[model samples]
Target: MIKKLLLTFSFLAVSMLLAQKNNDQQTVDEASEKLRLAMISGDKTVLESLILPELTYGHSGGHIDDAKEFVEKLVSKKSNFLTIENTNQSIQIVDKTAIVRNHLFAQTHDFGKEQGEVSLDILYVWQKTKNGWKLLARQAVKAEKKK
Candidate 1:
C-alpha cells in the first residue's frame, strides 16, 4: 500500500511538472505572436512592451540595432513594415528562456527610401521575466533570392 502511494505521488509530481512546462511554452508562444502582430502594425509601444529593456538586434547585413535605436526609428516614423506574414515558426524552451525561429515575409519601406518585399529568417530570444516573458535578442537574416 505504501509503495503504491509513493508511486502515485511520484506520477502526480511528474505530471505537474510537465503541465507547468507546457504552460510556460504557451505563454512564450502567445508573447511571440503578440510581438509579430506589433511589428506588422508598426505599434512601437507594443513592441517595446514585448522586448527586454536592453535588447540586441542583429541584421543580416551585419548591422546591429540596439533598443534605443530601434525604438527611436519607430517613433520617428523612419521605418514602416506592412503586409507582414510569418511562417515555419518553432519554439524551444530551456529553463527560464525560450528561442523562437521563424520565416518572415513583409513589404517594408524603411526610411521612406528602401521599399521591397523582404524575406527574413528571424531568431528571437525570450527570457522569463517577473512581469512575463520579454524578448532579449532578435536576429534577422535576409533570405537570398533563388535564381
Candidate 2:
C-alpha cells in the first residue's frame, strides 16, 4: 500500500511539472503573436509593453536598433511592416528565460526608402519579469529565398 501511494504521488508531481512547462510555453507563444500583430498595426504602446528597457534589436543587414530606436522607427513612420508572416516558430523554456526562433517573411518600407521585402531567421530571448515576460534581445539573419 505504501509503495502504491508513493507511485501515485510521484506521477502527480511529474504531471504538475509538465503542466507548468506547457503553461510557460503558451505564455511565450502568445507574446510572440502579439508582437507580430503590433508590428503590422504599428501599435507603439503594445510594442513598448512587450520589450525590455535594454533591448538590442539586430537587423539582417548588419544594423542594430536599441529599445528607443526600435519603437521610434515604427511609431514615427520610419519603419513600416505592411505584412508579416512567420513560419516554423519554436519556443524553448529554461527556468526564468525562454528562447524563441522563427522564420519571418515581411513586406517592409524601412526609413521610407528601400524595396524591403525580406526573409529572416530570427532569435529572441525573453525573460520572466514582475510585469510578465519581456523580450530582452533579438538578432536576425537574412534567409535565402526558399525555392
lDDT of 2 at 86: 89
Off by over 4 Å in 1: 144-147
Whole-model lDDT for model 2 versus the true structure? 0.91
Scored against the true structure, residue 5 in model 2 reaches a CA lDDT of: 100
Best-performing candidate as measured by lDDT: 2
Candidate 1 local lDDT, 82-118, one digit each (tens): 6677788888889999999998887877775868777
lDDT of 2 by residue, 1-147 (tens): 999999999999999999999999999999999999998887899999999999999988889999999999888868888888989999999998999999999888866488578889999999999898999999999898644
Question: lDDT value for candidate 1?
Answer: 0.84
Query: Over all chains combined, what TM-score does candidate 1 have?
Result: 0.90
Model 1 lowest lDDT segment of ten: 74-83
| Pairs in steric clash, model 2 | none
- After TM-score superposition, what is the CA distance of residue 103 in candidate 2 from its true location, in Å? 0.4
Residue pairs with clashing backbones, model 1: none
